[model samples]
Target: MAAAPRGASAADFETAATHAIILDHRSGRVLFRKNPDEPIPTASMSKIMTVYMLLEQLKAGTLTEDDTFVVSEKAWKKGGSKMFVEVGKQVRVGDLLRGIIVQSGNDASIVVAEGLAGSEEAFAERMNEKAQELGLDNTTLRNATGWPDPEHRMSVRDLARLASLTISNFPDYYGLYAEKKFTYHDIEQSNRNPVLYSFDGADGLKTGHTEEAGYGLVAAAERDGQRLIFVLAGMESARERATESVRFMQWAFRTFRNFKLFADGEEVETAEVWLGEKVRVPLVTAEPLALTLSPDMREQMRVEVVYDGPIPAPVKAGEPLAELVVTIPGVETVRQPLLAGSDVARLGPMGRIAAAVGHMIWSAE
Candidate 1:
């Protein structure tokens, strides 16, 4: 008989942000969530999409780092977090990218949008189209600069997803996020992402702020090969956003531990095999199974093998014959395949008959 594992109490961590999400980058797991799906003004975090679109162009060979784009009057005259790009001057694609990422420059974002799509409105339309294709259901783009608009909003979940994609898909360009400062037209500004300066494994991402959105950040960090991407919105101040983000990241890494529960070819259980020379077959996993859990939750973790009884006839080595289900409180259940560890040949005729007779006697008893 198979039994489900015991459940443990959920984590007690709390945060001040109204909307946030923490995701495991490698496994696509949601480590923590709070109103993640609710749409909110993303402020400058929406610039990530603008950057993503430009990276796509770079990858497609339509643009290059050395290529220069002419800054328009609209970009030079734009407000908030200026890259200070002068009108009628051609800036390298690489520098503009750094400006947007390191400086959170609205002007640089608008320049990229206009350079590619010919106008901010047209580029924003493309942004919406790309958002749909990326499965960002709660994301809508009104402009490249993330200027406040009732129509421009993204869910924290979507922001986290975008950050993940940007890091994973555009490794060559992702380094710009870690750059502390960028200089353009004799003006320099520091990267606004709080995690970059204080967090050990922190790298590039974006920060956003507006009267409407308050202060927000899309942040990523990696430690010991594990990466976490998180999004926070509706923070009351820059200090609050910085403090809460670091605390949340610390909790995620410190509280949970990833343990290797099963190694490849490690026998997990013995399953009955009918009409076979061997009465039972060893069941094992073909690959290692690693799970993340808190210490208390690990103590209560359950592992169950589910399969039909008396697997009939010959069983081949490495044949998938059972399921290994792991349950832990406050986390999604993990299912892994259990495979036959060795071959089990069918029983000879006499042996089969004797086994049948023994089975009948056992049934009668």
Candidate 2:
């Protein structure tokens, strides 16, 4: 594996972990990927999905923070990092979320699955459905608690997507991941993600470990306005994996800079139009587009505009006018649609005459 920059180094990582993934949460640009598509055991990282499904229930009003769930004898018997919930005790939905998130409590996770979906198997179905909705094509669900399930699988790239969607779509509820500790039945249990304390800008995320899965972490960190998410899986040791994650994130932030590709409603330059009152309609990116740039190469970068340009002027408000093509040296070209900012009416007689004259003058030039 390549070495990380000075502050964050994989050198400290003794593990020969094969896969890693990184993404910029703010720009939605992938910064780095190693063995990205290969399916691997998600280990305890599966809990992230478990939490996501639970949040879905809460949002749909099927569950509420104030609702209390009684821990069954079966739930308390669950073995893993735990919030120490005893059998027959009632725990709030909110408390269980914190326990599962911060403490990585298997008991809380199972209770949540059972409470929300009638059974853990039923909850796994929900997990798979949510993964599909998020475009996590490489992911499969087996357990609701991130417990060992050979059939349970996901890839580093897909895990990053899950983290991104979790953070992006559910900001109000995702805060449970940031809590350092959770208390239940008077027992205070701490979070397992080491990066939360060891790395700067490191915040809410989940960590996993098992004899078969080794050590894994799905973490998100923010420095300045840029937020980053990554998944580190199949490591030999816990400490090494944590160090490597921080190293990877630090490298991503220092190595790339954000560039604004387009702004909302800005005239994306003009495009040729025909038969409408107007000869050309302005093209714009449907939304604010952004990209990551290498510090040295940004100054030399350029954007190329293309497409049918003004098209026909009878275009509706959302009529596609042109394609704003972006060309960055040594990178893939990205094209965003340039739309008519507003409705351009069909040509009036004067409008047609004006267009004809304008076309003739342009042809002469």
Q: Lowest summed-lDDT stretch of 10 residues in model 1?
A: 1-10
Each candidate's number of clashing pairs is 1, 4
Query: What is the Cα-based TM-score of model 1?
Result: 0.88
The residue pairs in collision within model 1 are 177-204
Tens digits of per-residue lDDT, candidate 2, 287-362, equal 8776666665566566777774447667777777677766655555666777777666788898789878988999
lDDT of each: 0.86, 0.76
Best by TM-score: 1
Instruction: Provide C-alpha RMSD values for all models, in order.
Output: 3.7, 5.0
- For 175-248, candidate 1 gives per-residue lDDT tens digits of 88899988877887888888998889999689999999999999998887667788888999999999999998
Regions more than 4 Å wrong, model 1: 1-11, 60-62, 347-354
Model 1 C-alpha lDDT versus the unseen true structure: 0.86
Model 2 residue 101 CA deviation (Å) reads 0.4
